[model samples]
Target chain A: MKPLMESERFVRLAAPILVGAFLIGGWELACRHWQVPVFLFPKPSDIARSLMNDAPTLLGALWVTMRITFQAFLCAVVLGTLIAFLFVQSRFLEISLFPYAVLLQVTPVVAVAPLIIILVKNTQAALTVCATLVALFPMISNTTIGLRSVDQGLANLFRMNRAGRTATLLRLRIPSALPFFFAGLRISSGLALIGAVVAEFVAGTGGRGSGLAYEILQSGFQLDIPRMFAALFLIAFAGVSLFLLMAWLSKLALGGWHESEVAREA
Target chain B: MLALNHEEAVTSHEATASPSRKPSIVDVLSANKIYADGTEALAPVDLSIAPGEFLTLIGPSGCGKSTLLKLVANLIDPTDGRLQWWRGGFDQVGGEGRRLAFVFQDATLMPWARISSNVSLPLDLAGVPSAQSKPRVAEALKRVGLEGFENRYPRQLSGGMRMRVSIARALVTNPDLLLMDEPFGALDEFTRNRLDSDLLALWWERKLTCVFVTHSIYEAVFLSTRVVVMAARPGRIYRVMEIDEPQPRGEAFRNSARFADLCRQLSAWLADASLPSPVRASP
Candidate 1:
């Protein structure tokens, strides 16, 4: 029983890798057997070769997109938390401004991206702003709900202690909100990457710092389907990495206490 | 028996002990609670808590025992009348010898914090430096028999241990008045008995004034110097009974025929309290 339990994590990792490998193997064989055109659907081998050959360009594009995502995510976290704090401080403020936050989330970023680029002279700044807007809502909404979800008993305990507002916020509210806040981070991190890629697509900016989206755009125009696949692969890899990073962080912060992150024996 | 003047009863009980009595630690003068929806949680009643007294308030559900406890803790304000702390306004609370602490039904420890941190919350909230609070936290945990479990999170501990942590958190303030609202209500019977025993020892050792609320008649009979039985439907005190038992009570007192008799009497009072109030036409 102990040995089987110990091997569970390994089994979890192995199962997915096996399936992915099998699928990729089948795809390569089917394409080879049919002699499919490379332009129509790039083979995995072609995509890999393209990845190796254009390593420097693809890596640079990856870095640019990642920087934008990180920047937008950081800004969204800071501003969204501040906004949530204000919302918790007063119901009047929340009622007045929460609809606008919902409005921002509902509106399509593609439509807003072009207008933002035109208004902001720096293309990079415009892209970052667009990404930030796209990523901001989940942080706001999730954090507001979290901050308000304090245990009534704990709240009364704090009150009985004569804890001032600042002490209550810092000691009680913040700790209570952490699990929900981390949940928001897991979601918003992926959204930030999506927002960055989408904004770059709308901007269509091309230069030394052009992102993976621009690389894909350029490859499409040049009919380099293998290179386009490589770019798409990089974006997918980055999105997954961002998500995993957020999950790791959430675990680091809440693993000891939160039921969501704590490991329990079956 | 409705709205018994508990102060008078307490005075009579202590008549043989001393003539120069200390002032009541708390006074509830005509204090009552009515919710926003107009549900009367408690009817206007006057009561006083003498220092170092173990007073238990027992009632059925919706009896406002919790409401009365909250009012004493000042967690919620009474909708009418007022409560006096240390025979003065709330501003005098938290003073050197006038400190108050509360234990909730749920453990209410911050799950994210280690036991030591949770226990030290009151001190930390009071801006006491860590150097000053560390020893007090250790001492409080020791009192609750949770020493050396400081680094464990609330979730890591069992329900009984978590409740001990809650008690330690209350004790860390070195409070004169301890208001506990069914602190052991969620525990198993064995654990509840153990906690009740430990709690009585603590109260005796510290000479603390306690206003404990519980549904357990035996618990009230065993622990309190005086028990205030309350009734629901515009909740109010029904009767106040004096235990007339020896101090520092233990298993001997618990197993004695006198203990059984007292418990039986309290059980009858609780049954009476649980009956629906007499209907009255709206004014």
Candidate 2:
């Protein structure tokens, strides 16, 4: 009754701007007063200057990484949803195939990156496949659980109405699986970014056309800590932004029905 | 033999008075359900609910009341006895007799859907276009007194409100028969009483046949035209009592002496149903 969203008003408008300014001011002061080595931790002002100087290069690297992450993510979503549907439909398939999915998830992507790069001649496709493998498992597992988790009473009600199998799957199971699907998507977005970076790391895709991992490697070779910090910042920012994007998508899809979204807005 | 009393007699007489009428046979018959573990969930039972009469099956837990309801709904098959419907002159497979709707005790609404969409689900499955079904959904919501809560999710609603949505969903299709397995057994005293009155109002308005299952004697007495008491351990019917009350019964009727007397009779029958089988004494 008081207002639709006083809490959101406070958090969105006041909290972030204030906290961000405070951290920057504190860092500037510490750099100015304390005799901290610039190579170890560059001053916020220096880092800003370096970021401005290397804006074009950093932006290009960001674009490359983003393209890989997005392509991998799209593939993961399609393949994961298909596999989850398959698992939900047949116990035999799930029994035979689910352990392999679990094996893929548990095995470290870094350890397999070299082998993946060796097998796939194309560098970009190899990176994409590595990222897809990393991001695919959670979507399958979460969505499968969600699809199978319908209330038995409701299922019986559907049966009593003589609902066909396709109708039940489309109207009941998929919609029921949406929240879980989004949860897996949110987790996989971050993992997708990590997957891309790690695959690039192992493949050593170094050059002007290479991603941020190559930039970090280049900066390391030239003893350019500020540039390296700038590249690292870009990676972190990309991961956070992609995660927020997934969260926003989740909100759009399930905001009206879910309590999680409702609580956030409140 | 089942004899018609005054109310049923007048109703059946009026029904037969119409010309163009055909003799109605029992739609479902001689249903028996035994689980795979050799537990006879329902003993060989016979129940013949009329086309548009309200019949409540009241009993203790594990008495196969729900099992009987499920059998008639065709959710599960009877192990022994044949459950044949009179398909004579009807185009459909099992007769054009009636479609079945079930309402559970838990108000098992899909939490991901809005109340209006949830209520319209039966129509949605029956290939009714959304545009055509919207007005019916609105009417059903209005009937349940949930007119303004169409967009609210299940989590935002109170327990009674959710149950109303469930009832509205069941009634939206104008189904021929409603199989309710203790739909209001989860509500509080005040909410349950309100829903009881509302349900009677709905039944009177629609005149659909109902087979309600409940453990509460008072609820069975207040809502049902006839309460069929069932006993456990290879469950079978213990007794059946007809409530001599008018339709659209009010809360005042629930407090009436007549209502109390019926409740007492149902309670005694239920008590007898719950008791262990007795051995003959050497007299």
Candidate 3:
């Protein structure tokens, strides 16, 4: 049983990497056989070469985009959680204000970006606002569900003890909400990155503060396809890293008790 | 059709008891429950739980046993009538020896908290600092025979162990009145019997007033001073049988012929309660 468990763990890690290698190998061979133009679709070798050559510029832009994503994610977590608490505290407030939260989520960030830029004055703050709006809904919805999903028995126990609102929220609701809140974090991290990039595209601002999206736009105008692919790769890498980071943090927080994070024998 | 008026039964149980007694901890007076959809969950029953008495409510499903327990815990208000806590109103509850604690059937420990934290929840909610509650939590765990498992999570424990932790949480509050809703109904017979004995011992040692709900007639007879058999379809009490057994009952009592006789009597009462009610049929 112990050996079988170890082998199962090995396969879980190996399977995804094996599939990735096969797909990348197929793409490289297909590009060479077709003699595709680099501008149309750069070969894997060309993308890798450009990635190394333009490392400094691409890395700086990567840093800018990531900073915006991090800031936006923090703001969303704080504000979204506050709103969720308010919603759970009063059904009337949730009924009246929830539609507006939906409206904010449904409206496209790209379409809202130009309007926000006009009003906010500062370009960075406007981009963060747009990203924050994009990332806010999951935290609010998931945390609200978590807080309200307390066990009926536990709630009765608390009431039997005459627990006050603050005591119940801190001791009972908040701890129960951890798993869902972490789930929201995983989703919001990715959305924050997406929001930042889309806002950068709509703004099209170029300067010391330009993000990877601006670099991609610049490369497109110049027909620097290999460089554009490199920028795209960096963006993909950042998004994957953010997601993994959130997952790791979730495990660290909930691994001991939560069913989702705890390892189970097959 | 077999419904006995609450007054008649209430008097019988009290009349048999010793004359010198403390005020009854809880008086559930003519309290009935009708859900929002108009299902008559309970049909206005009266019960007075005396101090240090182990009273059990037993019947088939939908007999309002759990609903009645909830009403006793004040977890839900009666749709009509009222309840008195220690001869006073609800507001006077939770004062000194007047505290109440509840044990749910599911052993509803917060999965995210350690066993120690779970046990200490009532104390924490009451604003008792960690310094004061730490020893109390340890004592409660020891009382439930779970001293070394304090740092473990709820998921790490077995079903019986989890139930013990739930019992420990109730004990940590040092409550005078303990209400349990089919707490061991889900455990295997062996584990349930073990827990039943442990619970009986706890109740004896603490002199705690307890109202327990369960579906098992044997369990009702073994652990209760008086078993209240109830019927469904406009849930109401069918009969009340006093065990007339000695205190601190154990394996010897379980193996005794007297225990078997009492169980048979309660089992027959339970079957009668589960039959379609003649009162409901006429209506």
Please give the CA lDDT of all the candidate structures.
0.88, 0.82, 0.87
Tens-place lDDT digits, model 2, residues B118-204 = 999988887788888899899989999999999988988999999999989988876656789889888898899889888888887
TM-score of chain A of each: 0.97, 0.94, 0.94
The C-alpha stretches of model 1 lying farther than 4 A from their native spots are A1-6, B1-19, B93-98, B277-283
Q: Write the per-residue lDDT of candidate 2 for residues A20-78, one digit (tens) a residue.
A: 89999999899888967878878888878889999999889989888889999999989
Residue B241 displacement (Å), model 2: 1.3
lDDT of 3 by residue, A1-266 (tens): 56654687688988898999998899899999999999999988999999999999999999999999999999999999999999999999999999999999999898999999899999999999989999999999999999999988788778777789888888899998999999999999999999999999999989998999999999999999999999999999999999999999999999999999999955
Query: Considering every candidate listed, which one attains the maximal TM-score?
Result: 1
Q: Which pairs clash inside model 3? A: none
Over the true interface, candidate 3 deviates by an RMSD, in Å, of: 1.3
How would you class the docking of model 1? medium
Q: Cα lDDT for residue A48, model 2?
A: 82
Quote model 1's TM-score for chain B: 0.89
Question: After best superposition, candidate 2 residue B73: deviation in angstroms?
Answer: 1.0
The candidate scoring highest on lDDT is 1
Model 2 chain B: worst 10 consecutive residues (lDDT sum): B1-10
